[model samples]
Each structure stands twice: as structure tokens, then as C-alpha cells.
Target chain A: MVQAAAVAPVPVPVSTEVYQRLQHFYARQMQSSDDLDVPAWAGSFTEDGVFATNAFPEPITGRAAIAAHCDRAFAAQAAAGIVRRHVMTMLTAEHAAGDGERIHTRSYVMVLETRRGQKPTIYCSTLCEDVLVPVDGGWQVVRREVRRDDL
Target chain B: MVQAAAVAPVPVPVSTEVYQRLQHFYARQMQSSDDLDVPAWAGSFTEDGVFATNAFPEPITGRAAIAAHCDRAFAAQAAAGIVRRHVMTMLTAEHAAGDGERIHTRSYVMVLETRRGQKPTIYCSTLCEDVLVPVDGGWQVVRREVRRDDL
Candidate 1:
């Protein structure tokens, strides 16, 4: 008879201050997306943050470039008369031992879209992997990769 | 002209110990689900924990009931020959100010299903709301509500 070994647990410690800061960062990110505030959305990232998605081959880097990307995307959604709500849930974060100032987090993202006088629908489901760093006394996303789960 | 007020930020603090415990709790939950270990899956919750879903009208309460629920669900999945990967991401936990022992968390849950040779498909997407408490020196989910996004 073969014996099964118990799995050892992995411990990840995140400070109270860091946890709150990261929560605020993600809250702002979702709020900006829902409100279509391109500037606020872009400002959630670091000055040289990178945003990449499976749909786009090239990654968008820098705060300004990210702002432009959001502007174009929001404009297209507006033209289509589609209102979007981004609901982020199931967020797990780990402190990066290699870099004390950084944290790595993964979240489940659902993009809900609604048309005028129509019911909302789940437009997309994605897994978001984020690398965050403390800057200016607050946490900012340094890199965000959106992987489409529906694909 | 009236100027719009700046949005005040919401602050939620979670301790380093609590953060790591919650991460482990979620990890175990996902691991048990993937492994079809009913006892381990149900043990992730409190003895009197409640499991509720939008799809199911009645809530499954207590450890025994929760275990039975998992057993039935996993059996059905096995019958269908579907292997599921429960990817939990975007986990944000806030220490409840009024309750020192309890924490409130929200996470994004994506269930991907694969057959023998077919590519994986997004089986379901949900926003999970959980109330967790420390029991036996480890965090256990006291209440979990699954809100389906793709419904």
C-alpha cells in the first residue's frame, strides 16, 4: 500500500497597511473603469506601468500611453452605447520576499456590459495578474496582465 | 459653477498574520475542489458554516451538510468526466471593525472545465462573498455566498 504525504502549507504575510493600500488601489481601478475616467484609470498605475491583454499583441507601457489606451477603448464603448461595470473579486495577494516594496496579486475580473433599456450581461471574464509597488506613500500597479478565461 | 468633491478613499486594514491565513485558506479550498476531496473541502468552512448560491435557493448549512453538498457536486462532475480547475483571484479581505474575530472578503472565482482531449472551457464565473473567522488557529470560512456573473 502506498502512503499519501500531507501537503505542506505556504505562508504569505501581508501587513495591515499594505493590505489596505492594495485594496484602495484595486477599488480605484474598478471605479475608474466603470466611470470611464481615463485619467483616473491610468493614474492607478506606476509612471512606467505596463498593461497587457491577450487580445492585444503589444503591451501598453507608461502612464500616458495607458491613458491613451483607455481613452480609445472607452471611446469605442461609448460609440457602441455600451456601459460597462468591472466587478473584481477573489483577490489573493502575496508579499514579494525578493522585493520588500512589491506585492503580487491575482484577481478574478468580470466585465458586465449593458445597453440602453436592456439587461446587463457578462461580456468578459478574465484573470488579472498584477505586480504592485509602493510609490508616493500608496500602492500602484507596476504591471497588469489580463488573461481572458472565456477564450 | 459648483465643483465636484474629491472622492474620499475607503480604508480597510488586515493584519499580516490574517492575510497569510486567508491566502492559505483559499488555497486549500481550491486544492480540495480540484482533488475532489469532500472532507477537506468542507473542512475549509466552520462546523456551522453556511454555503449559499444564487442558483440554489436554499443554503447548505453545517459541516456535514456542506460535505454532502460537495460530495454530490463532485460526483456529478466525475460522472460527466469533467476535470475542473477552480482559479480564485482578486482576493481582498477587510477586518471587520466591530468583530475582532471575523473578516469579510470578496473574490473572483473562475471554474475551467476540460475533457480528455478538448480544450478547457470557462464553466462558470462568480463573485464570492465570504465571512471568515479564526478557528483552531486557522481561518475558516463561516459564510460563503456565490453570486454568478455569467447567469
Candidate 2:
């Protein structure tokens, strides 16, 4: 038998497969949010997910609460005929030293808002730090903190 | 001696190290352009690099020509007091069937422009397809095609 390194949680490099797997994960997660699919977007997170943003005074906890918050934004965007695209960039991911089920990621998200006959604008730019955990054969964001550049 | 794959240039998986290395490469390359450092930006490409964009009637061939083209743009942005940040997203890298030195990458770049005392705007969103080769222990873009989503 091979001896394993005895260490606690520390940043560990993942494989290329893991990296691309994450690319797909974010692509799907952000798409649901951009498409204003309330249930789908909420499903990207855990049942007890926590979302905190610099623009908001209080953190929105739990998947239902997060969904409620975004549902309103979605309706407003739809009413205004605005299409917002959540573009993910500069994503970096690492796993806990000893826990394969846990991963940490930091990504930059730029939201572009476009209206009919008008040029697209950078509605918002924020950095999202997420703590992800595997559940039911998929990954879910357990905690997300958004740092808005505008704020 | 170890056996090697006989394939020519197919999609080969890279390690996490290569993926992160590319992240750093783009971060530095885009920073130079955003800072209006024309020469520094040109240095990111090979001597015979080619840059094609739909906005231009003809492609810019060679690093010198590319530099000359961007130099004018940099001057104009400087005069207009615009800061354009190039944010890279959804980057996928793959190597040629058997050649380890040739790597192809497709990346999305979002350019956010900000003027003094004004909110930032999505100046441009583009897909950059690049062919990269190592030179003198560093990677240089040998060819690049820019596709603007706004076009």
C-alpha cells in the first residue's frame, strides 16, 4: 500500500478535466440566472445557500430567499425589455487539501445589459467567491459573496 | 523507455498547471493593452503573428503591422481618456494531435470602457481564437482571429 501525505485542508491543484468541468458548471449556472429561470437558478445552489453582496446591506440566505430576490430582478428586466448576460471570466478553482467533495472558486462576472436599438452597456461588474460542495452527483454553491466593482 | 501515442495533433488534455499558466498570460497581455502600452502588447505575439477583425477590411499581418495598428487606437483612446479593460472568459485550450508545442485556445473577451466621472460600459464583446507556440521558454500568440458579437 502507498502512504498518503497527512495534511489538512489546503489549496490543491485539480486536473484539466476538473477545470473544464467547472467551465461547464459556471456556464450552466450563469445561463439560468441570465435567462431568469427562477427555479433553475436557485437549483444551482444548495438548499441552504448564502448569498452576500457588497451592494446589499444584508446577506440573503437560503435558496428560496435567493430565488425570491432574483425573481423580482428578472421580472423587472423582462418588463423593461432588457437582456442581461452574465459573462464569467478569470475563473480559478482549487480543492481542499484532503476533501475532494469541497472546492473553492473565485470568478469575475460582468453583466451586460442591452435594450432594443441601443448599444449594450456594462450593467454591473462583480467578483464572486464561492464555496462549492458536491451533492447528488452534481456540484452546488454553498456560499457566494459578491463584490461589486461599482460599489 | 515509455510508449507514446501515435496520434498527430488531436485534442490532448493539459494539466492544471498549463491552464493556470494561460490565465496569467492573458492577464498580463490584456493589462498591457488596457494600459495603452502598445509595444508591450505587441510583444505578446510572435514576429509573424496575424490579427483579423471584422471591423477592419484587411487582416494585420506581422507584429510590426499589428503594433502600428494598435498604436493608433491607443493614441485615440488616450486622447478620449478611455480606460478599456479586456476581461477573458470561457477559455478552452487543446494541443495539436501529437505536437506538444502547438496549442489552440478559444476565449471570449469582454472590453469594458470607462471614462472619467462616468459609469463603465461594455465597449465590445469578442471571441478570440488563438494559436499559441512556445518561443524562448515563453508562449507567444502566432495567430489570432477576433469575432465581435456586436457585429
Candidate 3:
């Protein structure tokens, strides 16, 4: 009979308050997209926040650029008569000891697109890595990098 | 121009200790599956824990049943010469005020399947809702329900 070695659990280094705030941020993120409020969606990040993905090798920096990017993205979807719903899940946040200023998180993002009288289809699925910081007593994303997982 | 109403963030009610434990439990859960340690994976749940999914209408209840189910599932995957990596993300834990005994969470789960000589493919993606409770000074899953997001 072979025995398996015991493995210790790794603790996610984040305070309860930070975890709750991040969850709230993600919820608002999803809601902004669902409501097609591009400005609000861009406001989720910091003034100089970065949004990067494999498709766009160059990171979209600053709130203005982010808003423009979202505006175009949302407009395209509307033109196609498609509704997009972004779902973020399996999020885990980590912070190093004595480093209370910033927190890192990883999550799975799925974009579901649907048109009238059509079944919803998954348009994109990616793994998102984020860095968040506190501003004005609330959490704001400073950087976000998305990598395709469905390749 | 129509102005969108300002949306206040909804706070997630959970203590720092409980949040940390749940994160640790999930980390261990992923590790157990990655290592193919069925017993350890099953042990993550409570004695009367229930694992239910849309695909499996019948819930697998109790630690023993969960272990058996995992054993068979792992064995089948091994026999097929396929490697399955379960990635959980966007995990959010919440508990109502005055409800300290049980905590609720929502996360996204993605399973990537790879063969010896082939590229990795996404096997499935689902949203998971979990109920956890403290037992023996650690968090243990009491109930897990999975809803498929990609069909």
C-alpha cells in the first residue's frame, strides 16, 4: 500500500476587509458592463490604471483611454445587436507581510454574448491578474493583465 | 444626456479570520485535485457535506460517498491518459449579519484537459456556489452546487 505525503494549506494573505472590498469592486465591474455604462466601467480603475490583454499588446493606460476603449467595444457589440455579460469567478487575493498598500488577485473571466432569439455563447475566457490599491477609502484596480486560457 | 445613478458598493459580511480560512481551504482543494489525491480532496468537505452539480442531478452526500465519487472520477481520468487541471477564480465569500456559523461563496471553475501529445483544451466552465462551516478549527465545505456557464 502506498501512502500519500501530507500537504499543508497555503493561506491567502489578505485581510477580511480587503477581500470584501475587492468582491464589491468586481460586482460593480460586472454591473457596469451589463448596463452598458462605459464611463462607470472605466471609473472602476485608478486615474492611471492599466488594462492589458494578449489581443492588445499595448496596455491601455489612464482612465480616459480606458473609457474610450470600452466605449468602442460596447458600441461594436451594440451594433451587432449582441448583449455581453462579463462574469468573474474563482478570485483569490494575496498580500505579502508588511505590504498593506497593494494586493494581488487572480480570477477567471468569461464573457457571454447573446443576440435576440439566440442561445448565449461564450465569446471569451481568460485568466485575469490584477493589482489593486486603496484610494479614497475604497479599492481601485491599478493594473489588470488578461491571458487567454481557451487556446 | 441621461446621467446614470451612482451605485453604492455592497459590502461582503465576513470576518478576517473566516475569510482567510476559506481561502486556505480552496487553495488546498485545488492542490488535492492537482495531485490526484482523492482522499485528501474528499476530506476537505465535512462529514455530511453535499456535492451537487447540474450534470449530476443526484447530490453526492457525506465524506465517504464523496471519496468514492472522486476515486472513480480520478481513476477514469487516469485511464484516459488525460491530465485535468482545475482552476478556480473570482471567489467571493459572504455571510449575513449574525450568521457566523455558515459562510457562502461564489466562484468560477475551469477545467483544462491535456493529452500527452496534444494541446490543452478547456473541458468545462461553471459557476460554483458553496456553503462552508467551521469544524475542528478549520473551514470545511458543507454544500457545493455547480451551475454550468458553458454548455
Pairs with backbone N, CA or C atoms under 3 Å apart (clashes), candidate 3: A89-B89, A89-B90, A90-B89, A90-B90, A90-B91, A90-B108, A91-B89, A91-B90, A91-B91
Residues B125-150, candidate 1, lDDT per residue (tens digit)? 66688998877788788899996643
> Model 3, A37-146: lDDT tens per residue?
98888888999999998878699999899999888988987888876657787789987334657788998988866665555567899999988887787677889899
What's the TM-score of each model vs. the native? 0.61, 0.61, 0.60
TM-score of candidate 1 to 2 decimals? 0.61
List candidate 1 stretches off by more than 4 Å: A1-136, A141-151, B1-11
- Candidates in descending TM-score order: 2, 1, 3
- Residue A57's C-alpha lDDT in candidate 1? 85
In model 3, what is the error at residue A27, expressed in angstroms? Answer: 7.6
How many backbone clashes does every candidate have? 13, 8, 9
- Which candidate comes out best when scored by DockQ? 2
For all candidates, state DockQ relative to the true structure: 0.06, 0.13, 0.08
State the C-alpha lDDT per candidate. Answer: 0.79, 0.82, 0.77
Question: Considering only chain A, what is the TM-score of each predicted structure?
Answer: 0.87, 0.90, 0.86
> After superposition on all CA atoms, what RMSD does each candidate show versus the true structure?
10.6, 8.9, 11.2
DockQ of 2: 0.13
Residue A37's lDDT within candidate 1 is: 94
